[model samples]
Target chain A: MTYLNKIKIFVLVFMFILFTSSINAQWNIPADAKNKKPPIDPTHTLVKTGKDLYKSNCASCHGTPGQGNNIAAIGATDLGTADYQHSHSSGQTFFQVEQGNGGMPSFREKFSSDEKWCLIFYIKSFDKDFEISGEELKEQKADLRLSLVEKIRTVKAYATTKDKSGKEIPLEGAEVQFFIKRMFGNMQIGELVPTDNKGMASIKIPENIPGDEEGKLNLLVKFKDTDTYGKVIKSKTIKWGSKLKIVNITDKREMWGSLHRVPLWVLFSYFGMTIGVWLVIGYVVFQIIRLKKL
Target chain B: MSEVNKEGTKKTIGTIVSDLTRPIKNHKGFTIWILFLLTVMGVGMMAYVDQLANGLGVTAMRDYISWGLYISSFIFFIATALVGMLISAVLGLIGIKWITPIARIAEMIALGFAMWAGLIIIFDMGRPDRALNLFIHGRLQSPILWDVTVVTTYIAISVLLYLLPLIPDMPFLKKAMTDQAKWKQKIYKILSFGFEGRPEQYKSIKKLIRILAILIIPVALAIHTVTSWLFAMTPRIGWDSTIFGPYYVTGAFVAGGAAVMIAMFVLSRNYNLKDYITDFHFDKMGKLLVLLMLVYFYFNINEYIVPGYKMKAGDDHHILGLFTGHYAKMFWTVQLGGMIIPIILLLFRRMRKPLPSLFIGIAVIIGAFFKRYIITIPTLVHPHLPIQNVPEEFHSYWPNAWEWAITMMAIAGAVLIITILAKLFPIMPIWEVAHEEGITNEEMNKYVKES
Candidate 1:
């Protein structure tokens, strides 16, 4: 009885302390941290690393352009809007990113200070005033293809971005998504992948998927939205995999067999009653014919 | 009433024979009646041909309401066909002697409807040509196989029951009618089988009749029980009940009994056989109808109350539809006029008399036909999944003009068959009547009188 009373009193005191502390604690950053300037340049290589990290770690909650989708619903600010981008100094935004508020988690341990500054520069690019040249847009074309590996009996799709002059440029930061077109709709194959420095991205087509009756499959590779390059999709059909088989009849040993489904007594009784009644009817007809002789 | 002799005793065998054969001998309006029936049947056949040419798409039936008027009419005919079993076998076995005069009328009605019952189903099918598949590839487990088997057996037994008593009457008709065609005489002579009133022959005939009578009861029960199984075997809301067999049997008796009464009224009025089909027969039929309706009422309560009480998920919609929804009016009318009012009216002596009984009989017949309609159509519309993605018309059913024409023609066809049979044979069993009156063959010829 004493132990129960002690627990009840302890819980009440702890709840009271927690309630008062939360009410007083404001998510205000220090003035020195808010005024701090980034030491590194917003170079292309840094932005590329930031884009890959954003897709993997942050795009799910912040959305592709950080427009605040369902994830991190409470405090995921729309990073694209000019009001947020222009109002906050990069230092203030960096402090907020490092120290998350409410439903947002702190990314202090996950990313380096240099990587956080790269993310800030990339987020500011979503604003319309952050002008991108037409030459840069023309160079964002991705070359996507599918190839079958005969030794492994597996199919792989590769995506590589090319420059405007048809030069093979490394599309290091683009996200490649794979899909297979089915009769009803397209089915996603695997998780999205980021290309390496060599501008190469590939995924293994699963072995178990049943293709068309002729054992042909249509594989689709997509270069989804990226900071530098936009979106690109390509499809290829290959003769691979086993065809689907449909079996209508089963052996008598199986549960679905006719022998098991229909009971024998039902058969015997149905036939027995039918024949017995017909025999009686036949006798009556014989009686009519016999009446002809009377 | 039959004419009285000089001594005020009942007329002898000769007068009985002449009076009984008078309807067949008469020519008044017979052609017109046949022509009317044929015309209706012709119009129906033309519509059937149109249905055949255009496909079942012409009818109002669709994916949801697959069955319509033809199936209901088929059920009505099967139910009406039970009169032969009720009057001839059920009552006859119980020694109801008054039924002897009316038994043949019931048998004719049974034969007419039973024959068409088999044909009426063909009208509902999209491919009537595939009918042979039923016999060739019929599955034994299906209730349809049970129905076809029992309907054929019932038709055969009903024919034998109708023909056996006609045997003794044929020879009497042969001797009495000199004006009938020689071919008709030859046919009668063959049909009579030279039955010279031998004691051994009478004994054999009696034994055969008793054997058939005993045999018919089970077949009769099987026919309607199996018919009811067609609905009860399904998992539909209102039809899926254990009592459907008895419920259908009792309802059949009500419809069939009323049918016999109607035929009794019409034949007695038109053929002038007032003495033969007397007030006593109508009174007996009326009392039997009352008993039947009361038994059916008990089944009706059991059939409805238990389901209505629980108000199970699917059944609630169906019960509400019949009780107070769109179908409430027709449903209540059929219940009140068909079963309830008839039961109430027949309880009084005056209502059981010939004229009033005739009106009651008509009401019961109409109500019985609609009763089958109620049983079939509502359950179909109330299928488990909500009705969707079909035409607006598919949600409810009404028999269109084409459907009505075909259904009415089927009824007319049954009447046409009965008319032809009545024209050929003595409507009542002459030999049975004479035998019951204790008249002999020698007395029949000697006391013969010209009508």
Candidate 2:
């Protein structure tokens, strides 16, 4: 019994360590990103731009004044407190904003480098002591190659960032996001996948989700913004699933749902009353016509 | 032929016909009344144009309380229309002989109100242009479709019922009025259908009237029942009750009885029709009004008390609203002054007189209109879900000037229909009255087989 108890204790401690480390893994940043400073100063113009952008996009999830919302309760980082702003460098903040974390989306395609630097400065304004210095950011050209070749159910993407000389270089340590387009918004399908050494990421499509009316899917694979690579999005349309059964409305019973069809008794009474009334009316009309000759 | 009564007073067929047809002739007040109705209709038309230009926004209706004065007017007209069925069909089928005096007037009211019932629904529609969609995509399961169907059927039968008995009066008018217009002569000629008071013609007309009387009873009941279903089928709290059908039917009879009394009093006073529409007729109508009001009071108890006892979650709010909340004053006024007071007053001998009955009818009509308003607006105000985000004005409904004007026009329009119809034909059935007086045409009764 003592031996079994000790084994159980070991397993529990091991799991505790594992979970704690993985949580720390979510905030992983390279030494270069940590040391790098923001290229732009916190000018009034840049701060104003950052404030507007944050209100339009980030405030919905992160909350106004960076106080955080219910979305932040789940895993979103709160920028209101010094605990988060003081712990992270401006470059690291810019990288986090570009690439995004769990529920947040990559704003790399939506924001330029100056815009991101401005956002970082405005976010830093929440904490009094937050300050940073950095070198100028070099413009990088990047693109994503998306392909669906696994019998139409698997999505594969390769991302590459080019140097000033236009030479292709594998963009590693970057997160790739995959989403399916829906009527109102995009639905994330799988967990965020990090690019391998070859700058490739792949995710298998789940089987149960219904596609569009024509059984077509628009798969969006995005190479989120990295410090070295720019943001790139590539989408592919595939008709590689079973077609949705077209509802034959002509044959289907006219009802809101399957629950409330016209009951047989109601129809019986309605038609019965209708037929009986009309029969009487017909007799009356017949009587009137008979009066025509008189 | 003239006959001398026991008291030595002379009664002649010529005087009886002339007395009944006096209202059909041009009178000093008749033109003024027509002008008044036309002015009201004209102003209502102008307001309708404004409503069409600005949308239903011209009315005080909003998202929370969508229906307003127009729907209340629709319910009132439908209820009033049911009176024709009550006097003409229900009483006629039961072989009540005294009702023959006002039977034609009852049919006229029915035809006018039933026709206007359809128009009131159109007036309530935000997109009146899409009304054809009601037929194109109409579902049999919808209570509205049932209402539309039954109301149309009722109108058709009411029209026939109004026309069939007019056959015997046609030759009398065609022969008596030598100064009739060329067009009037043509209408009389066409409508009279060359009747020479044949025996077969009387038999056929009587048979047809009997069949229509039987047919209209069920159709009338169906019209009001299905109209009640339009509210009952909904998941509304106060409206979702088994008694709504009978409650609406009884309420209809009360309003109908009152409307007929008002008409009877007006015609009797205007044309000196005291000999035809007598004190006994008003007394009988007063008794009917009391009976109908009592039955309506019974159903009102069932409709409200059962729901008030348990005070179910949603219904509690609605019942409280009517019983003691914002709607309490209007609700109690209609119940007491419109129903209870009238019922109690009508129970007395002097109150059943013609002049007293007229005041009672006017009071009942005003009460019925407000009663329909209470039934419609309160339940909507206190929906299952608490009203939110809507404008504060939407928290309660009050019909604006345009709504009132338009609704008043619909009433005036019904009166106009009754007016034009009364002017065109004799308001009283001459042959039926003569038949009741035991002055049968020998030629018409020649082929009648004894039962």
Candidate 3:
């Protein structure tokens, strides 16, 4: 038993080593140079170009100063913040712009090299202090005023169970759940709130949330066990204007009953039995005829 | 009288020619009708050309059921072909006398179906023109390559097995032809290979067959095992199981047995081979089917119940689908109607009668075809990633008209080959049967002396 156990352990270790080595061999990046970079001048021509590009292209969605807004650009990122810019590299941004990052479309075919440089320049302009000085401050302010919307303060929820006759039905103590997904990270944040007597609940956004400058947030409201429990009742993303409401979460659930609900094993068994029976039947018939003829 | 005896000796060729042609003269009408039906099936195959020109989109197969009937039918052909190896080599090695008569027929069926299997695979390919890439740039590590290798080897062995025995018969056929058509004479002359029925030629034939029989066992196992590996190697929940190799082989034998039975029934009824193929043969085959069915059932239980017990998140969809989900109807019908019912029916003594067994055999073949479909499609539908972005029609697959027509054409083609062969050659081994029944000259002399 001891020897058998040793052999089993040996095999396990061997397999682990084999797998790790194969993975290591496949990754071609050098380890040491992952974190070296040159300092940036916030007011360079590159920076002005970047700013101009941002106003024309990105401001409509990401908003002025990268404070994300614009209904169509609800999922766009904020580039105004210093910490976020310093944490990511120009190469990373270039790659994302070139190849497309998630929902973003590729700009390689649409933009020229100088245009890409201009976009990068505009992105850097989000920084407050810079060495290069030729840009007019008035134009920048005008762009900002035209694009910027008030930041989201808080989200409030209201619910009621009544027909269009305006008669109110009690909906207190019903569990309400809120879900938020970040646009860039696609991370999900959720909280469950019990409805008050008026069938209303509000959630306050915590100050100093990580990556708040990016401002890409999608919110959803769902009720627990209201015949549409475990289903998304109401959902909306907040990007530009602050006020967002989730209504009729229950109606949507009835309209779309769980589209993604198939279990994996059921499909497997389906194939299994189908193939299994066909083979079994064919065998029996062939045998009988074969025997009779013999 | 001596002069008359000389004339008789000289007229031996003429007499044999008349005897051989007699059957064709009598059955020409039936032969013409069967050929006409076969030609219609050939016309159906032209529709498949339209599919090839259009694309697989021509088929009803949606993304969900991407591998519909063609794949299943391919599996059926592969499984049924297993008998060629099993009976011809496996039983032959074991010195089973009763199997010898049918061994050649089994081999021929194997070869015919194996060839059709290749053809159907080409038909199934999204890029049929790229099929040569399978060979030119074939990767040995891939199970598909292994399948290709083994199937080709099996075909070669099957042809050798069929042809070697025909050598002796070929010379006899050559001399027996009185008014042979040009093509027939040419074919006979080429195939005869100047065989004179000498002892040396007999010894060489026997020796080669023995060698081939020994070699064919591993090749046969490799063919089905490699086929199973095609699925098993995939990461799909149903196909990734290790039990697939033996599971596939068992299924292959089961299907192969059914194919052989079906062939026997058709040939016996058509050729009036009552003397050679009898009820006793059916009884024996019924017993074999029972054994195969039981073994398959054991594997089936293991395949389903073990996974069903675990019901892991990955396996959840597939298992539920078979149990009470969308595919539940097909699952239950194939398992119960195709396998369990046939097994139970064959278990009783009365049901083992030739006619009843024939009915059961046909059921097994039909059921096995659907079983192959179940094996392929559902697993594909339930991939690791969620289904998205594809068109709604991509979610399910049913055979389109072109696919159906083409697939039917393949089946028709196999039957056509069998039909043509039966017309030309004796379905039963005349020499072997003569020897077995003690009707040979030596056997007659022994009987006379004893009397």
Candidate 4:
């Protein structure tokens, strides 16, 4: 009995140890990724843009950064705390944001490197000792237009501004994003591209995308740095890509189908068997009626 | 039909008709028994009224335990009603001579319970008015639709099977029962179907009953199998099973068999049917019960052991609750008292006697009922999604006062139907008994009572 009790205690303690160790195990970062640095200059406009992105994407689960109000249960760090900010190098924060861990979502596909760095800069601003260190980006309004390269199937976006001579000039060094309109939201179609000296940024729309039954796609292009250029969008509907076979499941016979769409076999068997048996029953009733008349 | 004139020795046909038809007359005990059943039904009616007035909130059912006592009772009724097909069709077709005295008894139970099974499903509905939606909007793809089809078919066939056998027997009631009420004689006349013992009518009637007998087997299996599908269709912890169709069919036999045994015992002891439903009959039924239970117990093992061995996720809690957790007591009681012990005891010759078999029958039947409750209610509580954040009532279920009353009403209602049927007609078939005793149909048609 004593030996049995000892084994029971060992198992209980073992389980307890296993449970506690899984809570917030250290998140490892690649050595090369640890030394990385921001490639973009942080500015007040960049910080505002970062704040808007944070509200839309991260604040729901992670909560607001500096308020120390992130849902701690899901293991979101309190960015306002000195221990958190001081311990995390800029590169470490960058790697963490790009790769993510556990409940955190990786932003590698969702954002450009510059957008991630700017978002990181705004989060680091929660620390009282941190200071801004770059010239602020000035806000401006710009014109945006779209064109499709039919031969190459590439979609191009142009950003421009009027010069003092009232000529259309190139808006250089601004980022543009291309998208395809979908049911839930605009699906990102290509990488973020900076406007060249010609004021043009373009992306090759993949050939494999299945469009509407008529093979039409509603293509959209927008300025990435929304705070600087405002919400300028350009779009066009084009006949492109393969057709999708749209099947309304309710129109087909299925196990979970509607009343009218029962399978041919099920209807045939159900009615056929029922009527056959009822035919015998009908014969019996006829015999009874014959007996009645006699 | 016979005279006890100079000597007391007479053929048994005189006594058979008189003894069988004698129970149809006014008896004080039967009257009081019916009144008692009516009183129970009255209470159930009031409770049902409260349920209708207040929706289903008057019952203890919630989102989790959506099916309470009414559904289980519906299952129980369907289970009991299967006895008719088993005794009359399955055993009878194989030329089992002993079932003759008990076949109509089985049919009466079948018809009574089946009629109530349909009503009980409507009782489960909060809006009994929308019960027609089951047909109006019903799809052929669903198991519920299959259940409706087969059950209605079974009821139709059961009616034909029950009433058609009475055609040749009505001459005795019509001619010998001249002193009966004018309405009853008229009913017997209508039931006669002018069956004047013609050879063609005899040949056709036999062929017709044989046809229905053959038809009812698959329909019976379908009713129970489709009923099982209503549960097995879902991927719940306990109910999702491939073997559930055969398992339920076997278990139905056990419940239905026990029910027949109990009915046989009561009728023999109380209704002066001791000569026909004898101890020998009880012994044969007891042996049949053992066979039915062993098969059911085999399925029970398959149901629990494989799942219990794995103990995966929700099933672990469900199995443990029955094995050693909250449900352990009721679980063990049902297993030991209802099935295992009865199976063991009835194996003995003495235990197969009428009195002992009745006790075992009661235990098996009561156990069968709660087994359905255990099967349905416990599995619902241990659903796939974790139950969190609700009132304590939603945590588990026990049928409230209203649920119990309404359930009792269904049982009483079934009993009331069986009783009214018994009062109107003979519990044992007159034609079947006469045929079994070597009396010709022509002789039965010519039978006249000695005043």
Higher-ranked by DockQ: 3 or 4: 4
Comparing only chain B with the true structure, the TM-scores of all models are 0.96, 0.95, 0.89, 0.96
Write model 1 residue lDDT over B243-323, tens digit each, in one string.
999999899988889999999999988999887777877888899999999999999999988999999999999999999
Candidate 1 CAPRI category: incorrect
Scored on chain A only, each candidate's TM-score is 0.61, 0.45, 0.30, 0.52
- Give candidate 1's total backbone clashes: 0
lDDT of 3 by residue, B246-306 (tens): 8888888888888777777776666555434567677777888878988998999999999
Residues B1-451, candidate 4: write the lDDT tens digits. 1211112333466788888988787485987898899999999999999999999999999988998888988898999999999999999899888888899989989999999999999889999999889999998998898898888999999999998888877877776678889999999998988887777888888888899999999889999999999999989888999999999999899999999999999887788778787787898999999999999999999999999999887889999999999889999999899999999999999999999999999999999999888888888888788889888899889999999999999999988888888888888888778777777766765564333
Report the TM-score of candidate 3, chain A only. Answer: 0.30
User: Higher-DockQ candidate among 2 and 4?
Assistant: 4
Q: In every candidate, what fraction of the native interface contacts is reproduced?
A: 0.32, 0.32, 0.00, 0.64
Q: Docking category for candidate 2?
A: incorrect
TM-score of each model, in listed order:
0.72, 0.67, 0.58, 0.77
How would the candidate models be sorted by lDDT, starting from the highest?
A: 4, 1, 2, 3
Clashing pairs in 1: none
- 2 versus 4: better lDDT goes to: 4
Per-residue lDDT of model 2, residues B1-451, tens digit only: 2221222234445665776666666566888999999999999999998888888988999998997888888999999999998998888889887788799998899999889889989888878999999988776677887888898888888988998898777777776655767787678667766565787888778888888988888899999998888898888878888888999999999999999999999877777777777787888889989999999989988988899999998888889988999889999999999999999999998999999999999999999999999989888887777788877898888899999999989999999999988888888887777676556677223322211
Model 3 lDDT per residue over A1-294, tens place: 699999999888766655554454332323332332324434455665566566666676567654545433223456667874775455555555666543355789877766775676666555555344565432110000011123555565665554456565645665666656556533334466766786666666554444334454566666644332234356665553233344544434231222222233433443453345335334433332232222
Top of the candidates by lDDT: 4
Q: Residue A270 in model 4: shift from native, Å? A: 2.0
